[model samples]
Target chain A: MTQSDLTILSNREIATSVYEMKLGGNTISIARPGQFIDLKLDGFFLRRPFSVCDLENDVLTIIYKVVGRGTEHMSSLTAGSVLDALIGLGNGYETSTSGASPLLIGGGAGVPPLFMLAKALVSQGKSVTAVLGFNTAEDVFYKGEFEGICSRVIITTADGSCGIRGLVTDALTEAGDYSYVYTCGPEQMLKAVWSKINTSGQFSFEERMGCGFGACMGCSCETLCGAKRICSDGPVLYKEEIKWPTPA
Target chain B: MADTRVTLCGITLDNPVIPASGTFGYGYEFAKLYDINCLGTFSFKGTTVLPRFGNPTPRIAETPSGMLNAVGLQNPGVDAVISYELPRLKEVFFKPVIANISGFSIDEYVQIAAVLDKEVQVGWIELNVSCPNVHGGGAAFGTTPDSAARVTGAVRRVTKKPLIVKLSPNVADIAGIAKSCECAGADAISLINTLLGMRIDIKKRSPLLANKTGGLSGRAIFPVALRMVYQVYEAVRIPIIGMGGVAGTEDVLEMMLAGATAVGIGSANLVDPFICRDIINSLPAEMDKYGISRLSDIIGGAH
Candidate 1:
């Protein structure tokens, strides 16, 4: 991992409380698509961890939602503001395992990392389809961005204010013959996807972290192999080894 | 350049900066970021007789200039630590490490401490007497002088290496506890383990940490730590490893003046991985600024 000061190229509201920030810095250490970045914000003791949405040249794209005071401060940052960030954190998605046809699923803030995953698979000559879910149309984001790269894009909202009119699972039945599933989102949504999906897939999980490295074991999650730290071992895990059985 | 070296329990350290246990991992985590040999030494993760998966999720909560952790001492058990972790640590760190062990019984403490004493890399044994002694009605051993001295004497019999009784600040009488441990043959003392604390999520209408409570550490506890170190310095003759919210070099000097032979950086290491290394690097300049030629000369200077 590399610690570098990233200058904000742009930080703007994309949808409702959601924001897309472009940071300029050395992106060579970003090993894979699903890996994340931990940002050290001013006035905060713990550094904030966010998923990497896109990376091109020296510019790093991250999408975040204003969940608390930390994000609230990030939203007000102007151009030329620099952030100290621990870049290329956690194990990202392993795209080589994605078959010829892969379906990407995301819910709310979870949509950001899949956008990068979709781009990675598309570039690998794989046919990519994305299922983007939100609470409502106002919370929806990156629908068009996914549409630009994926062969097809499906949007779902819980309130029926958007495309599929249900949770992400509602649209999965007709999402075509996708060979694999790669998803990121809230735990409740991930549980739904874990049960609904039939194919072998990968799921990216989030946890409140300390250190955002291997030291603290603060972000550890139960797995078939053992208790693995989400920050370093993964924000991404294969569907089989994930020990969190579907909800009762 | 200022002299940063200090002698602790007959062993000389490069500086009085040892990364506290749990925050530094096995030391290799920071070794990948920078050379860890720059540290005086570090206390490895808290080990137990059995592997503890630790507390449930949301184990971390951010407070003002500090954080809370109820990680339940999630370690791979003592046997695994001896075989797996120590081997991994050997490749990255060159200095002898402080083996921090916790227990629910005196026998348990003796079992682990005796085992660690045989390991060539263990220079000191830090007995974390904060854990509830299951046999003692679940009250932490460090909370009372009797239990604290009991555990210290039990482990002291097995380990010939320097024994540092790490005290919990949750007690009503910390200085009394320190004096008891010293009487029981503790070679040194480390004070101010995280103060017991918790936070609530108003939206969820429940606790923020899954365990409901956690130990508070970081910049928020510096003053309290220094005070305890100062008090313990007055109560005992053993060396003091004072830590709690120590974020910079000035704080290190202050801790030494408060009678700490060493200062440990806990949660601050989580904020910036290179904090201990950076502190060690800047210590000389900070010492020069303070007009102190020797850090050893400052131990309990305030007293």
Candidate 2:
């Protein structure tokens, strides 16, 4: 909630419509892998929430897509501009839940956070396997980083332009024998993963959010118990707790 | 060790930071991220006598320096809230919870308030007579002083708890509406729910939001909200909960100086869930930085 004029450490296109920016804010130094920061972009009222892509020292890395007005304005920001950001938000993933043999799955922009999760697991002497998904080779991101940390890294694209042709689930199917799974992606792909995997897994769900913390119930999903706010209770939820929206 | 406490309508809150209605969702979800009780108070989603599906999706659209939403007061209705939501709320929150009630008619307001008044956990009742986003319902009741007064007077007859009337900013004379609510027995008034706006997708060649027009909120609306609050504060004898596009403690101080007894943070909470908590923690230290003591002492003192 602290406000700071963060200098752009690096803002560059990592994939088609996807970008990575390194911001100099002290808040970034304390950010965990799964937590996010809301960047107040030029000509936008609500700050855009981006997951902490990577953090080192005072540099906070955020990878985002130019999906709306906020990100569109963010894309036009140059190298030296100072932006106001609300950093260190939401509950990041807990490593204790990642078993000795764990599989990580990420799709599109979702692949960024898994890179940090892989690094954390490798440091703990855990065997890590990752499946990174993209729609095409140009859309693919974070291949080298995952390769550096995980024992095996599988890449999948919808078009036959990259690693394994087809979806991320196809890539995951190729690499088996995982004790636990951690995934983040579009709801449909997550539902596919949920259906195929019998093992306990952690998932991150995206919703049209207002007040990304617990304040607005705008981003709510029904569960067996009742409704839960996705931003606070989770952008991350245990697989069993999630009640998917039935297809229209 | 700092003093961050304030009193709203004689009800003591640990701080003046309340998560506005439609934002805090009864306080359970935020409780998972941090202690819910740490907040001054939290207002629940607007509850009506009957269930509501809300407006159509593509319900939200991003605007320059703000966003537009047509989330037409979606709730599981008042009875479901009392039966289902309240028990869950009691488990997660210990702080004061204000029930924000909305209705299409006068009797609906009374029925909902009467139900909430019996619940000891409900510290106050906030009448939502001023949401501009909904059709045939919201902005209609709020745009006219007579209708707003009628609704308030009807609810006042049934409820004993302190009542806060949330005013719509779309009205031409907000001061008249404030007077109407006060005359109708509203204990306090919260002004400037989202202003109405619309957007069209250039490529799709159609309105971006399904509702066509929606309520505008965020930093862009701050000035408009402040001006309305100042006008309404001058006209109303009761307390004012000023809200529009409050992003920080500085904005909070500005609203208070404009004569708001307390302020509400709406869309800013979406950007950062920890904002209320951050503002709460930073207030005293921020006040100290300005050589101020009590939050009340700082209110309306800005010249």
Candidate 3:
């Protein structure tokens, strides 16, 4: 990973408590769609990890929710504010492994990484289907953005305020069959998608991380192939190897 | 023109800047970023007899100028480390690497030590007596002088390699514990491990980390680590590898003067992946500013 002072080009709230931030920096290291960037916020001891939502030459975009003190601090910053960030962290999704038809599913904050993944899959000439999930209509974002790139877009809300009523899994019956599935969201949502999906796919898992890189084993998870670090071996894991934790 | 080499437990390191365990993985990971051979040597991840999955999610909590982690010594079992991790490490890192071993029981510690002692690349075995995340073993042996010495003595018997007992800072008398390990035949000592600390999420009215508490390390703990290293230096004659929030060249110099024969860079690695390399690269110029010619000459100079 490379550390650089990235200038914030824009910081604006797109949805309820959700924000879209654009940063200007050397975007050379951000080589993959599912890769993330870790920001060194002032006064905080650890750097905060955010997935790359979109990347253009010298520009990076990320979406974050105001969940904690760090993101809250991030929302307070304006354009031209500089952030010390470690770019191109974690193993991103392997697009080369995608089949002829691929499905992308995202839930809440997890939708950011899928945006980039959808773009990459579409650019490869593969038929891509995007499924976006949120709790309510006000919480939904990037619907128009996904419509521009993906072949089909399915939006799901639990409150029935928008699109289909119920969770992402509730809308999957109408999403048609796919050769591969890629998804990221909360554990419950991921488990539901993993159980309902028909084909082998890649699932990106999130854990509270220390160093967004492999150095810290703080985000380690147990899998069929021994213990793997979520930051390195994944944020993305294939369907075959994932072993879900027994519910408490 | 300055000599950066400092010998730890009879093994001479190219420099005194060794990346601390848990922060540097098995060396191969960082070796991909920069030439890790520039480092004195790095202590690999804390190893145990049985493979560990570590603590639950939200294992990390941020503090001012520091972070607390309850990673609870997550490592593939010693067998996998020796068979898989070390072989890959050997290809990238040519120098003798320090092996950091942690266990839940005395026998487990001895068993792990005995296995690693036979590895040719392991220059020193850093016996972690103060891992705060685990339940029964780790810090329990470190908080008291008696148990610290007992674990030290048991492991010291099976390993012919230099045995360095890592001390925890979350103790009543850190120096006493250091002296106890020294008296129990520890070849050297390394301190201070992360301090026990916690943080609360006010809105949720719950602990930030699922583990509830973790060991604090980074720039915030440097002064506390320096004081403990100084106190331990006065109490024992064995060589000391000082670490606890050591980030830059200045911190490295200060740690050596406070009685560190060598230094370990911990939390700083999380902040910057290339920090150890940066510190090593900047040491000579910084050393020149302080009018020091030989890096080893400053060890315990403050005393």
Best by DockQ: 1
Question: Per-residue lDDT for B1-303 in model 1, tens only?
Answer: 689999888889999999999899888878899989999999999999999887778899999989999888888999999999999899988888999998878899999999999999989999988632122422378888999899999898998999999998888889999999999999999988998889999999999998888888999999999999999999998899999999998999999999999999999999889889899999999988888999999999998
Instruction: Please give the distance, in angstroms, between residue B13's alpha carbon in candidate 3 and its true position after superposition.
Output: 2.0
Ignoring the other chain, what TM-score does chain B have in each prediction? 0.97, 0.97, 0.99
What is the lDDT of every predicted structure here? 0.91, 0.81, 0.92
Worst 10 residues of 3 chain A by lDDT: A40-49
Output the TM-score of candidate 1.
Answer: 0.98
Tens-digit lDDT track for model 1 on A1-248? 88889999999999999999999988778999899999999999999999999999889999999999999999999999999999999999999889999999999999999988998999999999899999999999888889999999999988989898999999998698889999999998998899989899999999999988888988998899899999999989999999884443
Per-chain TM-score of chain B, candidate 3?
Answer: 0.99
In candidate 2, how many Å is residue A201 off?
A: 2.5
Candidate 1 chain A least-lDDT 10 residues? A239-248
lDDT for each residue of candidate 2 in A119-157, tens digit (9 for 90 to 100):
888899999999888999998877887888799999998
Residue A130 of model 1, lDDT score? 91
